[model samples]
Target: MSTAVKNQLRVCLLSVQYNIMREMVNKVTFLTSVGFMVLNNAAILAQWFILLRLREDVGGYTMREIMLLWGLTAASFGLAHILFARAFSLPELIIGGKLDAYLVQPKNVLVSVITSSTSVSAIGDFLYGILLMGLCGLGLREWLLALLFTVTGTVIFTAFALLLGSVSFWFLRMDMLEGQVVMGMVSFATYPDGIFEGVSRYLLYFVVPVGMAVYDPVHVLVSFDAAMLLRVLGYAVLLTAVSAAAFYRGLRRYASGSLMGARV
Candidate 1:
């Protein structure tokens, strides 16, 4: 790589390190928030145990498979929040004119904004993901597959958030729209892919792609389909391109809020 590119990466990494250190300043509060989130997630997973007891499976997913799905869901979301938490609040940043600080920076605006802060609670969710994977009795290969899926899924989740939040550049009141899109993606991501059919299924793979982030990953881990994994990775790349294009295009329409503030 060129020296300039290497320098840019070094700056980004340092920025991320600073953000993490900031988050760690209040170690007690950070640890408590992370621990509570993990417990809350576990409570939600417990409902699946009750449901599975009443039937062989729900949405063609066995109990074990469902566990994997939850694991992937939490892990992907955890990574997104940990690294790209600002993407989730892109609408607010734009609408509130908070992008001005990032705009003045020499680095990539989106990356700088997203990596400006780290979500401490997400660390717990990531640990829970590993614990759940162990519960699945995954072999070394499956564990590695899960890690790959988590990485791609994290990128996809962040891109999707950016795509949805970019609407604020055109319509300033996109908070509701962002919530709907994100919540819909999360709702579908934790379920079996077989449950949805027809257009809904198509939308899952295309519009939102929660299936690719969660279901397809789990499926690939279980069966190891080269084509399917490639499709997931390919879709992530395409989504990322689309998201970046959309953000920059909308930036042309961005009216500065003129308020100087950093993302908290």
Candidate 2:
């Protein structure tokens, strides 16, 4: 790899490590946050279990397949938050002039900003996801595919958040719209793809891209498909590029809040 790429990666890793350490300083709070998140996710999964018991399947998904769907979704969501938690707060930062802290740093502004924080509860979601995937009885190949899907899914999710949050540049107070768009994507991703049809299905694949993030991954896990895997990776790359371009384009319009504060 190039020296610049290596340096950027190193900076991101250090930022993530520092954020995690900072969150862990309050051990009790850290544990409680993580535990509560695990319980919250489990409660949601339990609803599916109760519903599945009554019916053979929902949208062509049985108990095991549903597990895979939830597993992928939770794992990807957790990983995204763990690595790029600040992406979700991009709108607030833009409006509040928090980007000023990142812009002055000797690192990629977007990377520095996004990696500057960590979500303690996300560790719980990641663990719970692994537990669910284990219960699904995946083979070695399936396990590898699941891991790859998790990474791609994380990229898609974080990129989507950045894309939505970038709107705060041209428009003022876009936090609500950004939250709704993200929530809508997550809400649709937990269910089976077979349920949506026509326009909704198209929107899932193109507009929100949940189909690329979750549905296609679950389908591939059920039955391996090289072509589908390639498409998922392609979508991830495309979305990342678009989001990065949008962020830089918007950066030119950014006005400093002129508030002075130290990151440390």
Candidate 3:
């Protein structure tokens, strides 16, 4: 692509970013956010109620314990999006044909893409995540460990999401693939990682990357173990570096799906 063409695309994406930020202040965004918060956190609550009724039947967890876990996990769920929804939207940018515009932009495409979009719903998740973090039950040192792990978890989640999203450049159905993967991650996220073990635990922990978001961090926090903290922190940094490298490598292959470069 030519220089003038590239600059024009960056300018256009910047404009879109500004418009999105402006729209964030409106009533419509507020109401939609309220509705989704109700929906997203509903399952944990409903389960909490059901568990309370069946407390005698289920041997392991009490009503209060389940509720506490739900609240804790829910908060982490919120935190993940709050910190990295822009990166999470990488798949959408690819599928929505927005990437076609981004490719010609003079700025780094990843940076431009992030600036151009915001997941407004992330704010709701952020509020709840903070609540969970407080109650995860830790001494000052353990709390510090949890905070560190939470930050580490964010890095892992963002990197995992981006790696998955970047695959869309090669696959046509970016949204479908992204939705499936994200849904899988969400399904495992709030639930206690203790239920799965051996091979099952192995899958989530090392293979799929979902365990990074909740299980590993929660464990490290509860135990205040130095080794576990280092392990998770290492995964966070290493995975993030690997994922970013993968993204830029894929960016080089992005076709832009245009033969003539028509847009101004």
Candidate 4:
């Protein structure tokens, strides 16, 4: 790779390391927070277990598949928050004109903004996902697919959040709407694809991307179709491209808050 590219990667890594170290300073609080998050995520599985007992399957998903769904969703959610926590706060950053600091930085502004913070609890979510895969007794191929799906899902989640948060630059009072969209994606991701039909399915697959992020991954775990996997990957790439384009486009219109003047 070029020296410039390598330097960029190095800088990003340093930022992540520094953020993690900062979070680790409060050792007890960090550990408790992470542990509690894991327990809380695990507790959600109980409801699924109970629901599975009531019927042979929900939306054609067996208990095993449901476990994989939860694993993929939790892992992706964890990875997004842990790494791209600042992306979710884009509406706030944009509205408050906090992008000025990042604009003055040598690094990419979007990257700098998104990686500015780390969610310690998300580490627990990632670990739980790995544990869930083990519980699924997946073979090597299946395990690899799960990992690929998790990564793809993470990218989709982050890109979608960027897309939603970018809307703040164009319109007022979109903060609550942005939160609702993220929450909606998260809620739908945990459910079965069979539950949705017609336009809703298309929306999930293309518009909101919960399908590519979670539903499609579940399909891969069950069937292992190469074409379907490629489709999901293609969607992730397209979404990332679109989100990046939209964010930069909106950045041009961002108004500098008075806080920027106070920074000096």
- The best candidate in terms of lDDT: 2
lDDT of 3 at 142: 61
Q: How many backbone clashes does candidate 4 have?
A: 0
Each prediction's TM-score versus the true structure: 0.94, 0.97, 0.75, 0.95
Model 4 reaches what TM-score against the true structure? 0.95
Candidate topping TM-score: 2
- lDDT values of the candidates? 0.86, 0.93, 0.64, 0.88
Q: Considering summed lDDT, which 10 consecutive residues are worst modelled in model 2?
A: 98-107
How do the residues 1-264 of candidate 1 rate in per-residue lDDT, one tens digit apiece? 598778777877787778778878998997898899889888888788888899888888887898899899899889888888888888988888778888888878778887777788888888787778779999888988999999999999999999999988999789788978898899888878878899999999878889889989988987889999999999999999999999999989888876755555
Report the lDDT tens digits of candidate 4 across residue range 100-180.
Answer: 888999878888889888889989998888788779989999988999988998899999899989999999778888889
Query: How much is 182 displaced in model 3, in angstroms?
Result: 1.7
Show model 3 residue runs off by greater than 4 Å: 1-20, 35-43, 52-76, 95-97, 100-107, 135-139, 258-264
RMSD of each: 1.7, 1.1, 6.0, 1.7
Clash totals, every prediction: 0, 0, 2, 0
Tens digit of per-residue lDDT, candidate 2, span 125-240: 88888888999999999999999999999999999999999999999989999989898999999989888999999999999999999999999999888999999999999999
**What is residue 130's positional error in candidate 2, in angstroms?**
1.4
Q: Which candidate model has the greater lDDT, 3 or 4?
A: 4
How far out, in Å, is residue 52 in model 4? 1.4
For model 3 the local lDDT of residue 132 reads 48
- Total clashes, candidate 1? 0
